[model samples]
Target chain A: MQHKMLYVLTISFFKSFYRNRVAFFFLLIFPLIFVGVFGIAFQFSDPLNSPIDIGIINNDEGVSNGVVILDPFQGKIVSAIRFSDRFISIIGNATYPNNTTKLFNVQEYNSSNLELAKSDLENRRILALVVIPNDFSIGFLAALRNIFADDPLLQNITKNWEGYPEPTFSTKIFIQGDQTLQQFSIASTALRQITEEFFSLGSSKVKGVTISTESELTTQGLTVFDYIFPGLVIFGILQTLSAITTLAMTDVESGLLRRIKITQASGSTYVASMILSQLILSLLQLPIMFLTGVMFGFPLSSRLWYGFVIAVILMFGITGIGFILAGIAKNSEAAIGLANIISVPMAFLAGSFFIVPNPELKWTAKLLGGNTIRVLDFLPATPAVRLMRTILLGQQSIKNSWFDLTLLSTLSGIYLIAGLMTYSKRHFQSQ
Target chain B: MHKIYSNGIHAVKGLSLEVEQGEVFGLLGPNGAGKTTTMNMMIGLLKPTKGKITIFGKSIMNNGKEIKQKIGVAPQEFSFYSHLTVYENAKLFATLYDVKNCERRIDELFNLFELDEIRHQRSDQLSGGQKRRLNLTLALLHDPDLLILDEPAAGMDPQSRAVLWSSVKSLVRSENKTIVLATHLMEVADKLSDRIVIIDHGKDLVIDAPEELKRKFGHGETIQIHVKGDLASDEFSLIKAKVKEIWPDVKNSNHSLQIHTDDAIDDLSKLLELLKQHDLKQKIADISLRSETLEDVFIKLTGRKLRE
Candidate 1:
């Protein structure tokens, strides 16, 4: 009988809300506008396609000795410039690249003029400038002596230079541009990787310590859209809780809440119907955002159901928050004011707008054995956003998200119980 | 029950009364006389600071659900959802009451209250009198054993007021339903209530039948004469001396003279004859004689009119 009453009330509230055009604007039109503005701004722009311009000042002076060189098979008079400017040897595509394509737009500066190169870098002509010292080739050959120690044929060529003082080679790489932190980080990292690869190749056959680099096929590169959409979806779900709070406060000010209390309807039934109605509205809200996101080319590596499951769990937590707001507020205006206070800061700090780097507050948040505090991990929206990112980006499966799901579920349960208790006491006992 | 509000203002103080079954008990007071506070306490909308209330042999605090099922309250304010149609509001209440045969019951109420034509209209769009009737109908939807109507005929036209009075009269006569009513309309209380309680400043001043109260505090007969011109003290004393010779009960204020008599039908002609002998009949603009009423009793007890 109680279930039947709750079901009836839920249906009635849905009908009432359906006819409320003002509610329609808040519940549906408002979020759609948010999605539209973001979609148009980000649809064609992928953050991974950041432009990187690097200048290489290759000043390596090579040796020209009249020594007979041996080809592998015919032993012909094939001469090779043994140690050349290897920094200039690296190549890159002029445009954005796929996995097999070069990673940068590399430019070679012939003159070692520091002032001219600095001017080009300052004028944004290059993201970074790399300078190879003049003794680069001599140092490169000396490092290879250990690798070729067993070969006598190679020993005679380098016998004249046996005690040659080893030159300390300095490869000064300057990162200069009006670039953001993320842009500067990406450019500097790429330049170091390319320079190290060439330096490693100079001592190719060294058997003692082998250094090899591999890029995994399973880890997909994330675009800015990939990083932000999960947070936006979670944000959209949590925002509906404020709308529900406003509706509940409206009921209170209208005296509908008191009138219903005077009836045979129990407080639990009223709260249950309200929560169920909000859940239904949230279910309606998620799809519009998901569809808009997909239209704007938000990548969907995992199936759609994974995002939906996370959304439902997040709705429970958000609805609990709505109940707490409803309990504390006296009217619709108060409810709206209180809801903004709770939601606005959480949205920003919990990574709804932009990622709050874990390192920024690492000492504070990571007080537990180099791990983020458990309470911070379950701060309503943080875990949901992270879990959605991992699942939708195909970085982690559902089985690996047990901790995140448990935290969200526990928060949902605790908040729901606390909200119900507080609301019941405030409304029933006070009245 | 007693009610001292959260602000420490004593709204109702140790006020207690028992309403008999099948009786239309009237609660009367001037504005701010704690009538609303008392009614809210009776219906469990407010918590009293002292004392307790028991309805149907069950405590209201612990047995609210059981008591609420037996009682239906129509608060003085407009409490129905204004966005819904009259029919929708009635249907909602019927559903809340869990009444069987809801549609037929609603149809019956619609016809009985003359609301059949406007049943589909939104409640806010209705005339004030129609809204009042609809409010009363909603309170009666569940056929509660105890119904509380607070100023039910307020903002109503005389015709609508009469219609509601007749319906309430029939409900008590036919169904023997107990009702607790609070109103400032003396005529309403005087005509409908089997017993009336007048409260002032959070205290009950008197509780008895309307006629009994009138007989106790009311002068027998009141004759008011509106004079055209003000009389001097000597002239007023001369008229008072002559009228007091027979009736002996008279007061003069402004240009009006009020005379209390045992029998207006017998003494009215003699009083007018004395004025004519003095050639004062030409100065009398109007003369009216009426039996003492509850309004007079209210003013006699509170030293002010009911609306004051």
Candidate 2:
């Protein structure tokens, strides 16, 4: 009999919510707008497609050995060349494998305008500044002789060389930028690779070492949108807090709550009906948000069910907080206001937008068998968000997220019990 | 039962009354007279500060859940979900009460209240009269034994009020349900209630049948005379002195005078003779006699009008 009543109540609640136009706007349209706007914004600024701007200062004076040499590969006579100029030319003409997009927007700078280049770097006009020293050719020739000395065949080919200075003067090529900037790191790494390849061509004996990266997840390249998609979905789920809070407060202020109190329906049945209705809403929200995210270039995860599990667990906690707000508020307007005050900060603290720094407050919990607990772990959203990112972006299975799932489930249970107790004490108890 | 709020408001003082089964009991009071507070206490919505209230010979405080199941409340405000349609609202309550054959019960209520045509319309869009009818309809959906209606006819037009009163009467007559109605309207209490408790400042001043109380505290009958022309201050004072000789409670305002009397025929003859001797009959526009009503009884007990 109680189960039948719960079912009827849940259906009634759903009908009441969807029939109101304002509720439709908040439940569906509002979150879709967030996805649409953020999706477009992130796609344009994606680092994988956009080129980094860099400035090159080539100051190398050519080392004129006054000797002509035969190129082994081309079988043509060659004259001494400034390696610095060659390196700068290679960097200025570098293009991505797509052949249409350039790897870097290289801006040329002279010795006299070095300060100007540095100023441009500070203002983010350029990500990095490459300064080729005057002794660049000397450094290249000396390094080539050292490599040939290691290989006897290369030493035989360069033994007849004349008018070349001894391999003793070694110089450094400086790459300068703000270390804090991410673009600066990419720019420096690309420049270093180009420099190494240029020298490898000078001496046939020079060999280069390469490192490769592989992921256990999908082979598809992950973008910023993919990484933050779970957070966005979690944000949509958080909006249910306002809706549930407003619904509960409206019942109280309208005296419908008191009216229901006089009915045969137990308080737990009513509360369960409300939670079940909102849980259905949360379940529906996850798929809509996820599909919307996929349309906007978010990577589709095979482990989508993992995200659903996280949403259901997190909603239990959110619904509990909603009831708490309803208990504190005197009316629907105040309930909405309180919901915003709690949910907005909770979204940020849970890293719904960006990764938050771990809190400094840590203590050993004797109750948990001496396990260290951070202040953030107490918030259900913290674990829910982390678990979602792990599943959706990292493409890990549910087995890898047991700790986060357990923490989320425990916190959600605590909140659900707390919410029920507070609502009962506030609304059901006589004055 | 008594109720004192947490904020130290003595909302309901030592007020007590008994509601017999299958009878319409009325709680009549002026504004802020603790009618709602008293009704809330009876339904276990509030805990009385110092009193005991029982329903069906069981303590309401201790057996709240069991007692509450047998009672239905229609609060002063429109308490149901406004977003739901009339039929849906009825169905919701019926289901909550675990009514057998809820569909048939809901249909019966909708038909009884003439709500069949607008059953699909959202409650918030309902007219004031329609909303009041729907409020009463939802209360009767489960066929509760005791129905508590707080200002059920408040803000309704005369036609809608008559429809509600008839329906309420039918519930007691045909359904054998007890009703506890709280209202400040004296006519509603006089017409519908079998017994009424007139309370003021959280205390009951009188408790009896409406006619019995009127006979006990009423001023019998009143004769009103409307003058055609404005009289001089001296003429008015002379008429007042002449009327006051027989009935000292005569009241006059705006060229009109009212005289309270137990013997209307005798007083009417004396009043006419006094007017004729003074040659004031030519100035008399109209004269009428009316019996004292529950409003008069309430005023006699509280020294204030029911609305005040």
Candidate 3:
């Protein structure tokens, strides 16, 4: 009974799904739009300037030390002032700078306008501000004299001096915020590097501390095209097949189907055939995209086979989800609306475009990372970067592979059950 | 077996009806009179809160698939996929019903309904009459033993209605199909149905053959005839006595007359002659007769006019 029913259901789904042009495009074309757009949007490899309009304010007026005791504000500040050109050129360069650019953006400010500048920084108009104190040179000299007094090598001058780099003259460079942990870490490291380079007594004298990040991404030499090819393919097949709210509503709308229902076709068998038809289309999607990506210079060679399985599962799962949602809605309009609602969120949150452990995590990221580690400790995709790094990079394993599978399966299960229940309930209510 | 159930709806109560093999049974009623609900139950689209239905000697509830194999329905309201061609729509339905030969069946239905010329036209583009023809055609395509139709001709033109009726009649003659037709059109029912069940407010009011029920419960009309000239109450009785010489027990009132009889037409002839013999200037001021028709019988039973 099951076998015969399944056979018929499979054929029915195939015939219905392939026959519709809209369903064809939804399955094969729509998802690639996301892939192409998001891929280009996040590419990060353009040699041209990034389109972010960041402002930098440097309020350091050149300071000269009178006492020369601490020698606090003399060297670095003087050096920066003398060569503001170079600092802006490298430091403020978001991309390959024009040949004429200086390292940083310097906005000279009156003491009165300083508060306004701070407000600007808070408003995100300016990325960072550099403030040089008014008695910078003299205060630094006094502090330096104190430091010399404590210095073992200058032990004889101890009674006459204060601390080194006079407190009032010490310069402060403020990046706008410590809002995100990654940014905060970069800022702190850069600051520490600045302090160290200046104090280093060795021959390898560095000009200033700068934060430069390098990313190493390898799709097993399979290239990004290969990775995307499979994802898009899976999306294609999943969307190709179709089912209404209930196996029975189709019967209700057409008297012929109802008659057939009374004839030999079993409901379960009919429904099963329909789902199987969709699965076939979904399965078709991955390979088509996969081959296209490979042909298009995408390096997707690493664990290439897994893409097929994953895509098929996700496709079937999403289709099931669509059915379930349709089942709950009063009509086709509601079903369409609900499917979009869930699909969009899953795409964004589940790393269909980008991998993120918790995209909502920002300044309090450290806390979330810890919590994420605790709550999502079992699933590899808990921290999205970790999962992508593993899958695309061919990392051996994640925290708990079984846990990842279990969580994903649970999610898929929810969509499936919900779809089935909704379909049944709504199908009956359609009268 | 097909069954529909609704709670808090005293729509159907112990309503046991059957259609023998190759018989046409009509369930007749006014609008909102549980006919649709009853048919829905029979189709298993609705689950009855109480009672049981066995079709072909098998339970319809929980065994709908088995019952569906033998039955077809043409619902009161017709809906189909608007985007599809007639052929496409037919084929899709055939597949949903798991027909073995979808293409062949589509051709068959298209030919049967005389829709072959517009087989490729989108269903939404079809005329109301054409769509209805399609509606009827789909029900017949499956070649089932039992068919159910609910208000099948409510909006159809007479020409289209004739087409539908002819096809239904042919189904009975050719396939020996058992049918349950629910309609309020007494004339249509009287013409096509072998037996009829009348219902109101979810309850069965009466069930019999059209002729039998009319004979059993019909209130034959009472005709009052008023002559132009003045006459006393006793004089009218004398007139009746003379009229009874030809037709007896013809009741009358002063300056008026009353008769309780089924044959209003023939009695009126004899009534006119009596006035002639009395040397009365026989000018019939008013003549009213209560004649029993199906409409009168329905009103008598349901307490509301059939058309209402």
Give fnat, all candidates.
0.36, 0.82, 0.20
* Superposed model 1: Cα runs more than 4 Å off: A46-228, A300-303, A357-371, A374-379, A393-396, B45-47, B224-262, B266-286, B290-293
B1-308, model 1: which lDDT tens digit per residue?
67887678888877989999889999998878898888777778787788888888888888888898888888777777776789988887777777788899888878878899999898879998888888877877887899898888888888988998988898788778999999888888998999999988888889999999988998787999777676576776666677777666577788777887767877788878889888877767799988888888888888898887
Give lDDT tens digits, candidate 3, residues A136-214. 3333343344344446644444334323343333333444431212222233333334433343223243222222222
What TM-score quantifies how close candidate 1 is to the native fold?
Answer: 0.73
True contacts kept of 3: 0.20
After superposing all C-alphas onto the true structure, candidate 1 shows an RMSD in angstroms of 9.4
lDDT of each: 0.72, 0.79, 0.56
User: What is candidate 2's lDDT per residue for B144-214, written digit by digit as tens?
Assistant: 89999999888999999999888878878888999999999998998999999999999998899998998
Q: Per TM-score, what order, best first?
A: 2, 1, 3
Question: Which candidate, 2 or 3, has the higher lDDT?
Answer: 2
How well is each residue in A371-395 modelled by candidate 2, as lDDT tens digits? 4455777888888887887677653
Give the docking tier of candidate 3: incorrect
RMSD in order of candidates: 9.4, 8.6, 12.3
What DockQ results do all the predictions give, each relative to the true complex?
A: 0.32, 0.59, 0.12
Ten contiguous residues minimizing lDDT sum, candidate 2 chain B: B227-236
Off by over 4 Å in 2: A48-220, A365-372, A395-397, B227-242, B253-255, B281-285
Better of 1 and 3 by TM-score: 1
